[model samples]
Target: MTDRDAGTAEASARPGPGTDPDPLLRIEGLRKSYGDEEVLRGVDMALDRQDVEVIIGPSGSGKSTLLRCVNRLTEFRGGDVFLDGESVLAMDENDLRRRVGMVFQDINLFAHLTARENVTLGLRRVLGMDREAADDRAMAHLKRVGLAPQSESYPAELSGGQKQRVGIARALAMDPDLLLFDEPTSALDPELVGEVLGVMSDLADGGMTMLVVTHEMGFARRAATTLTFLDEGRIVERGPPDRLFEAPERDRTAEFLRRLTDLSEDRDR
Candidate 1:
C-alpha cells in the first residue's frame, strides 16, 4: 500500500461519535494458491461504509480471486476477511454469503424460474420468508432494476442484460452489506452493457458498498470512490480515480491503464 493509501485507510477507520470505528470490510494478509500457482499474495484492503471500490487488473491478476475469498466462494490459503468486524471464516458459510452477495460474469439464474422467482429463492429459503412476502420483496427489487414488468419472464426469455439485471436484483434481495461484482457486464452484447452498468451506477450513487472487478472504465471513472490496480497478485496502486487516471504514482499502473484505455477505444471503434 502507498503512504497515501495507508493514510486514507486510517482516516476512514477513525470513527465519529455516532459511527463505528472498524471498516465495513477488511482483508488482511490474504493469500490464495491453486497448487503451484499463487493467485493472491498477502493482500490487505479495507472499505468503509458506502464506499464503492473498483478493482482493475489484467486477466490473471487475482482480482476475482480476492472477491471470492471475501465471500468464501473460494477458500484461501492464509489470512482473514472481516465483514463489519466479524471474521468471515468464523461465520457460517450461508451467513457469510448472505452478508456478501456476489454477481458473476455469467448470469446463473435458473432456466425454469422466472425473474421474480430467481430473486426470491434466497428470500424464501435462506431468509425463511413466505411466498407472498418473498414475492412482494422480489418485485420491489426487480422494479429498482427497471425489470418489474419482466418479473414473470424466465431467463431464457430475457436478454443478456436483463438476465444480469435479474442477477443483480437477486443479490440486492438479500440486502447484503457489501456486493461483489466480477465482470458483471462482460457477458453482455456491446449495446446491452449500458443497461447493466446503469443499474450499477445507480447502486453506487445510492451508497451501496461495492467491491467490483470490472474493466468498465466509464463506470470506474464515474462511480468508484476509490480505484485499485492489482497485478500479479498484488496491489500496484490505490487512490482516487482522477489521480490514477491523470497522474498515477507508479509506472506500472500508468502503463496498464494506458493499455486498458487503448483496448477500450479499439473495442469502441
Candidate 2:
C-alpha cells in the first residue's frame, strides 16, 4: 500500500483547529539558520487536504527554505513539522519523501536518461518495482502532465517547460499526499511559463494538495485557496486569494503585491 493509505486513518481522525480534523501538513515554531544568519523564524503554517496554498515573497525571504524543511532537504534548528499527524523528524527520510513530493525550480533530470527513464528510476530503485511495472507507472504520470509523447526523449532534447513537466510527472508518480513546489516556473522563459502553470492548476482542480512558492500572481489568484505573504522569514499576511489581492490586512502585504503586479504588467507589456 502507498504511504498515503497508511496515514488515512490518522489524517481523518486527529483533532485540531476548525471544524475539520488536523491538516495534512502542519509546521509549528519552525526555525532555521545558516551560519549566523537565521532564515526562518518561528514560522507556523498548516495545509488541509486538497488545499492549494500559495506562498509569495521577495527573494531571500526563506520561501524555498521552508519547502526544504518540510521534506527535510534541510534540517531546521527549532519547531516541528507534522504530516498526517506524524512528526516529520520521526519518520524515515525515504518514507517522508514518498508522502511529500517536491518539484524544484531547477529541473534536475539526468542528462543521459530519457524522460521515461528519469521518471522510472525512483520507482525501480526506491519502490522496488520491476522494469515493466515502473515503466507503466511512469508513463501514466507522464500522460497526466501531458508529456507522454516525449517519453523517449532525453533531457537535453526537451524544452524548459517540457523538462519541468517531466519533473512534475516524476513527483506525481510517487503518489504523494502533498506536493511542494519551490518556484517551479521561475526558471522558465516567459513564453514557456504558462504550460507548466496549466499543469499545476489542473492538479489543484483535481484535489491534489499543494504548497507552492511562486511569483505568478495569476495562478495564485486563480488556483490558490490561501495566499500567504512571507517577508523576512515570517508570515506577514495570509487570507483567501481574493482578500489578499483586493484588500490585504497589512501595508507590507499590499505594497509587495502592488510591486509584484507592476512587474508582471511590465513583463506582459
Candidate 3:
C-alpha cells in the first residue's frame, strides 16, 4: 500500500498551548538511495507545532522522494521519521500510515469511485468506521475543501481543481497529524491550480502541519512558515519564505529562484 493509504490514526489533532508540548512531526538524518545513487542524504528537519514548511527545488532534486520517505512509502537507507513521537520507519504499515498522509501531484483518486466514496475508503476500510460515520466525516472534509456538492461525481466527471479537492478530502478523512504534499497542483491546468492551492492555503491558515515539495514558488511563499531548497539530494538553502525567496544566501539558490520567478512572471503576463 502507498503512503497515501493511511491505515492508522495517531493523535487526531493537536491540542493548543498550555495543554502539552509535542512536535507534530520530526525527521532526523533521513537517507534514501537506489543502489549507489543516493537521492536523500541525511536530511534533518524539525517543524514546530502547527508550522507549515515548504520545500522548493528543480525536477529530479529528490524533493518528491524525500516526502515519500517520510511515510515509509520508499524505504530509506537510514534515519528516522516520527509523528507525535511514534517512529514511522519501525512501525507497522497501518500504524505509520494512519498518522502520515500524502497528496500526490496527480490527485490519485479512484477513477470508478464517487468523490465521497474515495474520501470514505480510508475511514471505512482502515479505521473500520461505519458508512454513516465515515461519510459524515468525509462530507465535512469535502465541504471544508469546498467539494461537498460534487460528492456523488466520479473523478472523471470533475475538473482538475475538483479532483484535487477530493484528494485532499480523502487524505483528511483519516485525520493525519502530518500532511506531506508532493506538488499537489503540478498536474493541473494553470487555471485549475488556484482552486487546489486555495484549499492548501486554507489548510495552512487553519493550522494543519504541512510539509510540501513544490515548484509553485508563489504558493511556497504564500503558504509556508519555512522554505527549504534542495538539489541533488542535498538541502542547499533554507530560511523564512521572504528571506529565502527574495534574498537567497546561496548563489545556487539565487540563480534558481531568479530563473523560476522570471518564468512565472512571463507565464502570468
Candidate 4:
C-alpha cells in the first residue's frame, strides 16, 4: 500500500464536504517582497487539521518564502496568516513560534550542546520547564525519531541524517499545533534521505499537521494530502497528489513535474 493509503484511511472520517470542515491554517492574499522583488504574490490556500501539504516548484518560485511566512520567520509585506481562526500576525512572536514549529533545510543544532540539550533548550527556556521535565520530554521525542541513543552526542558527532532527525526531534518536543519543513532532506546525502523521509512518513501516519517544501516527489506522492505548485510567486495549481502527478491541469504544472521527473531519472542514471 502507498504510505498515504496506509495512513489516510482515517482521513475520510474528517469533517468537511469531502475533507475537514474547519481549516487549521488559512492564508489569504499573502504577499512577500525582498526590496523591490516580490517573492509571493496574492497566494491563497488552506490546510485542514492533520493535512500534509507538500509544495513543489522550481528554484526562485517563492516556495521557501511561503513556508517562512506561515511561521512568521519571514515577514510578509501584505496579507494575513491565520491558524485555528486566530491571526498569526497579532500573536506574540514567542507564543506564535511555540504554536508553529519549524525544521530547517540545514539542521540548526547548537554545536556546543548534545542532542538532548538541543531538544530541551526551547522547552527549558521558552516553556520554563525544569531540567528534569525538559530532559524527559526531549528524550521522548528523540526516541520517536529513533535518536534516543544519540541523545548525549553533539551535532558534530552525528551524521547528516541523524542531525536532521535531531532537528525534527527538537521541533516535536515543542508539541506545536503545526510543523513546517523547508526542504528537510535537501542537505542530506542520497542514502541519508530515506531515513529522514521515513520519519516524516511516520509523522504523517501519526496525524501531524505539516506544511512542507520539498523536491522529494516520492514522499509527496505517498504522504501528501494535497500537492501545490508555485511559480512566479503564485500558486498555479493544487489538488490531490495522484491527480497532480499524473495529470496536472495547467501546462506549466505539467511541464514542471516533467522536468523534475527527468532530473530524478538523470540523477539515478
Candidate 1: residue 141 Cα off by (Å): 0.6
Local error of candidate 4 at residue 111 (angstroms)? 1.5
Give the TM-score ranking, best first. 1, 2, 4, 3
Clashes of each: 0, 0, 1, 2
State the TM-score for model 3: 0.90
Candidate 3 accuracy as lDDT: 0.80
Residue lDDT tens for model 4, 1-269: 23223223323443331254468898877999999998987787789889999999889999999999998989888999999989899999889999899999998888999999999999999999999999999999999999999999999999999999999999999999999999999999988999999999999999999999999898999999988888878777777888888887678888999998898778668
Top lDDT hit: 1
Reference-based TM-score, model 1: 0.93
lDDT of 4: 0.88
lDDT of 2 by residue, 48-74 (tens): 899999999899989999999999999
Candidate 3 per-residue lDDT, tens place, 1-269, comes to 11101100101221322123456677766788998898877666667667888988888888999898888788887888777776776689777787778899988999999999999999999999999999899899999999899999999999998999999888888988878898998899988998988899999999888999887878888888877777777777666778876776678888998898898788778
Higher-scoring candidate on TM-score, 1 or 4: 1
Model 1 agreement with the true structure over 22-54: per-residue lDDT tens digits: 889988879999999998876777888999989
Once fitted onto the true fold, the runs of candidate 1 whose alpha carbons sit more than 4 angstroms away are 1-20
Question: Which pairs of residues have clashing backbones in candidate 1?
Answer: none
Error of 3 at 117 (Å): 0.2
The total number of steric clashes, by the backbone 3 Å criterion, in model 3 comes to 1
Give candidate 2's TM-score.
0.92
Q: Score candidate 2 by lDDT.
A: 0.88
- The C-alpha RMSD in Å for every predicted model, in order, reads 3.3, 6.9, 7.4, 6.2
In candidate 2, how many Å is residue 152 off? Answer: 0.5
